[model samples]
Target: MSEAQDDDVQEFAASLTRMKERTDRSYGQLARRLNMNTSTLHRYCAGDAVPLDFAPVERFAALCGATPQERLELHRLWILAVAARQRSRTAAAEATGTAGTPPEPAGEPVQDPVSPEPAGEPALDPVSPEPPHRPWFRRRRFLVSAAVATALLATLGSLSALPDDDRRPGASDSVEAADPPRATRPGTPRPKSTKSPSPSPKTSSSPSAGASKKSSPKPGERTEEPSKGPGQQRPPAGVPLTWSADSHVWQAGCGHDYVIARSPRQVPPPPAPQDAETWAGTQNAVHGRQTLVEVSVQGRTSTAVVLEALRVRVVGRSAPGRGSSYAMDNGCGGALTPRYFDVDLDKDRPIARPADGNDSGVTIPAMRLPYRVSAEDPEVLLIDARTKGCDCSWYLELDWSSQGRTGTVRIDDHGRPFRTTGIDGLPRYSYDTSARKWVPYS
Candidate 1:
C-alpha cells in the first residue's frame, strides 16, 4: 500500500529464509508451521507467488519476532503483490473509463478490489462499532528472541579470548560431539568447543547464565587461553616444548598411521630410523615382580591387558619431574609391538585366551588429550603442544624400527602412559627450581 510497507514485506520474506536454514527442522515440520503443502511452501519462500489472505501465514512469521510493521507489510504484499503483473489490465480499465467519461478515473486505483486504502481497518463504515483491541504484550514475542540474542553475545565473548599458540588440550572439551575441532581463522576467540565443562544446565533469566563447574586454579593461577594446533605432541626443534591437541581429536599414543596425511593442518614427516637395538626393542624381563594394572575410562567397565611386555621397569623411585630413579624393564613380548593384543604376562597363572580380570588399568585424569599411549621409551616427543600447569620433564629422542615405528609413550607419576605433549626433546620427569628446571644425564 505504501513504500514502507513494501520494504517490510521484502524483509520479512528474507528473514523467513534464514530461520529455515539455522535449525534442523525437517521439510514436513516447516510445512506444518506454514500450514501449506510442503512443495508450495518452498515456492513461496523463493519469492514465486504472492498469496491471498496472508494473515494466517503471516502469524507464523511471529516466531521470527519481526516487528508489527513487518507484519503489516507482509499483509500488504499478499493483497497487492500481483498488481505489478496486472498493470496491463489496469491500463485497459483506465482507457475504457476515459472513453465513457466515468466519474473519476483517478479514484479507480483506490477502489481496486485486490488492495484497499491505508489503516487496513476495512472501508466498511469506519465509525460503526469499533473492534476489540489486542494488548501490546500479547502481540509481542519476547522470550524466543531474547534467548537467541543472549546466546549470540556469550558466544562472541567466548571466542574473543582464545590463545594464539597451538597444541594444548583441556578436559573441558566434549569428546563425543567435539563442539569445535578444526581451528577456524580467528574471526573471534572462544574456548575449545570440546572443552564444554561437565554439562550444567544454564537456563535462567537472571545474572547467573550458562553452567557452572568446580574451580581448579592454583593460588594465583588464571585460566590460560587455549590453542588449536593438531596432534597432542609438539613439533621438533622449538623452545622447551610446543604442543597442541585438537582436544577430543588429538592424536594420543606410541604412534599413529599414515592417515595423518589427510589432516588439513600441515605436519612434519615421521622420525628417521636409527639403532635397531636401542630404539626398536626393549626387554620385558620382569618375573614374580609385576603389579596388576587395569584401565577404565569414564563410567565404563575396564578390560585390562597385563602389559605383556613389561619393558620399562622402574628399579627405583621418582617424583613429579627430575630423575635418574625411573627405569625401563624392556620386555618386548619376544617381538616388538604397537600391535594391539590381549595376553596375561604371568606364566604361572596360565595366560587366559580371553581372560577375566584387571591387569594394567589407565584412567586419564581430567584432560581433553586426544593422544595418549602406553610405552616405556625414555625420550618422548609431544609435538606442537604448549605447557602450562603441568610439572613433567620433556625429552625428544630419535627412534625407529620398534614394531614398524610404534614410537614411544610418556609415563606420568601414576604409572600410566599418556600421549606426548608435542614437545620435542622432553624428558619423563621434571622439578621446578629457582634458577631453572633440569633433567638427569642420559
Candidate 2:
C-alpha cells in the first residue's frame, strides 16, 4: 500500500475514535443504536473495516452530534479510504497477474482472526452481520431519543438512508486492521450498562393527596387498606375511560386524555372538584390564537396549530413570550418536564378555554394529560409541551387529515397505541374531550 493511502486510513480511524469517545456511549450502546453487531462498529472505529455505503456512517456521525465541519472532514476521509482500498485490490490483482475469483460476501460466522498483518499494514476482514441480543425496555429511553433525532436528521436531509430493517448488512465492505487497538481506546470490549424499567407510582383503587410522596410497593405486591370515604379520600375526579393491563394504557372517562409511563405505577386519582380552581384559571390565560406556532422540541423545530374548534370553544390567546407546550399533570403541582405529545389533527377538539368558574370547576372525567399540538407531518402534529403538574405524565392527540378535513384523535399521553379490546367488551376508542363523546372513525 502507498504511504499516503495508509496515512489516510489511520487519520480516518483516529477521527472516528475521538468522536465516538465524545459521545460517552459504550460500543454496545452504539451498536444497539446503529442496529449492528458491536464487533462491526468496533472494526469501523479500529479502522479494521470501511463501510461500502455511507448510510450507516452518516447515521453514526449524526448520532454522535457531528458538526457540519466535522461531517465534511469525515466525508473527505471516507473518500480517501475508499480510494486506498480500491488501490490495494488493484495491486493484489496485478501481483497475481490473474483476475482472481471474487470472495464470498460478509455475514459468515466469525472464524478465528487471520494472521496479523505486518506493522503499519491494514488488517482486512469480511464484514459480518450478527446483532447482539437486546433485552426488553433495555436502552429504550435512549433509543427513543435517538430515533427522534435520526428522524429529524432524515427530515433535514442530513441522513441519506433510514431503513426499516436496521439489521441489513452493507452489501460491500472491506476491513483492514490499521493498527492494534490501544488499551484505553473505545473499540476494546466493555461491560454493557445495566438499565431497569422506570419506576411506577403506587397504584390504589382510590386517589389520595400524598400518593406522590409515598413509596410505591414492589410490582405485583399491593397493600390493601380500609376503603376511605369520599371526604376522606379524593373522589375519582376525571371520568373512567380505558385501562389495559397488557399495554399499561389508562384513558380518562371524559376521553381524549391519556398518559404513557412505566407499568403498574400509581395512576393519579381523578382531580378533585375543589382543586379545579387551580387549573381552571388556565382557561382565562390563553385560547384561540395561533401565536405560539413554530416551537422547538429536543432542538428540532415544529409548528403549533391552533384548530378552529379551540377558537370556537374558548375566547383566549397564548400568553406573550410563552412557549406552547403540553404534558400530563400528575397533580404534583410542580414544574412540568418536557415530554413528547402527539395531537391528532382530524379528531381532537382544538385547545380551547373552559366555560365560567362552574364549568372550569366542573370535574371532567379526563386525565388532563399534556399533548404537543404540532408534528413534522402536517396531518399528524407531534407537540413538545410542558406542564406544572407533578403527578401528570404526558398525553397525545392523534391528528389525521382527509378530503381537506382535519381532526384530532386522543391517544394516551405516553403516545402508546390503544388496544382493540379494552377491559370491557367495548372496542377501544378515542374520546372527543370537546364534544364530550367517543370519536368514531369510518
Candidate 3:
C-alpha cells in the first residue's frame, strides 16, 4: 500500500474511536448493534485495516448517535480511505508492470457463469481497456489535499470570531464535548465558567446588590462578633432584600467540596457531591474556618440559603508585558492601547494577561467558604478587578471572615469591571470627566 493510503486509513479509524466514545457505549454493545464480529470491530477501531464498504461506515456512525455534522465528517474520511485504497492498488499494479482490473466491491453478489456459445461459432476477441494515467491521478490527489486544508482554515476562523455571549451552558465546546471545570493553580484565581444567565435579584437602591436570607441558628450555637475592616460600614436597617430563586454551583479544585447555594424562594434538590475532587488545590483560603453552610450530599437536599453581600476590593496591580499584551490594532489604527493587567485581590497578587483576543480586563475566581454573614456587618468582597474590553464580561468572588465568623460572595458584570485605559488602582465604576458618565471598560 502507498504511504498516503496508510495515513488516511489510520485517521479514519481514529475518528471512529472518538465517535464511539461519545456514544458512551461499550465496544461489545457497538459490535452487537452494528452486527459485526467483535474482532472485526476491534480491527476497525484499532486502525488495522480500512473498511471496503461505505454503508457499514454510515450505519456505525448512526448507531453511535453522531450529529449530522459529525456523520458528514465521518463520511468524508471514509471517502478519503476509499481513495487511498485505490491509489495503493494502482501503485502496486504499476510496480508489477501489469494492468490491475478493479475488484468487485465488498458485499456484492456473485454473478452466474455465462453459458458457452453453442457449438464452435467463431469466438470474437474481447477489447482491452486503456490504463489510467498515473501523473493525472497524482495531481487529483494533490487537489483533494488542498481542499481539505482550506476547509480546516475556514472552520478555525469561524470559531475565533464567536462573541462572548454566544457561549452558553450545555453548549458544545470547540471540540463538541462537555469539559470538566478547569482547576486554577493555588495563589492564582480560579477560572470562571459562565452558565446561561438566569434572572438576577432586584437590586435595592442600597449599595450592596445581593441580600442574604436569614437562616435559623443551630441549637446552642454561639455567634461571633463582627470584625471592623478598612472602610467598613454598618448594614442598613430594613427587611433584608431577597435574592432570585436560583441555584449556583461554584467549581474549586480537588479536596474541596462542591457548593450549590440556593435562594430562599426555591427548594431545588441538591446534587450529589462528587466522590473525588474535580481538580487540585491547596485549600489555603478556607483554612481555619468552620463549615457554616449545610451543603447538599449525594441523596438529600439542604435548606435554601442566600448571599448577604458581595463586595470588590482592589488588592494589587500589574503592567502588560510581552506575555500580557493584547493586539494594538483592534481594527482601530489610532494610539496603541496600554499593556493589560489582572489582579487577584484575595491572594494579594497580580495575574497574567489572557492569552486570547477576548480583551478581558479582569477575572475574579469563585470562592466557597465556611462562613455566614451577620445582619449588621454585610460587607464581604468576593472579587474585584480593573480590566479592558469593548464587548466582554467578567466574574468576581470574595470569601471573608469577620469577628471569627466567615461568609462567601460573588458578582457577575458585563464588560470589564475597570477601565482598561485608566490608572491601575481605579475601579471600572470610576467617573469619567470626558465621557460625562462612569468610565467604560472598553
Ranking by lDDT: 3, 2, 1
> Who is ahead in TM-score, 1 or 2?
2
**What is the Å distance of residue 150 in model 1 from its true position?**
69
Superposed Cα deviation of residue 291, candidate 3 (Å): 21
Best by TM-score: 3
Q: Can you write out model 2's per-residue Cα lDDT over 1-442, one digit (the tens) per residue?
A: 7888888788888888888855424565677899987668878888878888888888899988799999999999998987898898799788876685433335432232342333453323336422344222233345567779988977878445655344433332222222232133222332211111111212355466436443322222222223344445332211111111112111221111232221212222223332321232222112111111111111012333323221211112222222221122222331211122323222224342222111224432221223322332112112322222122122223232222223332333122222110011112233344654433321
Q: What is the TM-score of each candidate against the true structure?
A: 0.20, 0.25, 0.26
Candidate 2 residue runs with Cα over 4 Å from true position:
100-442
Residue 13's lDDT within candidate 3 is 93
lDDT of 3 by residue, 168-224 (tens): 343421221222455543333333322221112123354342245533222111122
- The TM-score, computed over Cα atoms with residue i paired to residue i, of candidate 1 is 0.20
Superposition error at 248 for model 1 (Å) = 17
lDDT of 2 at 344: 26
Name the better of 1 and 3 by lDDT: 3
Candidate 1 Cα misplacement greater than 4 A, ranges: 1-12, 22-24, 63-69, 76-80, 88-442
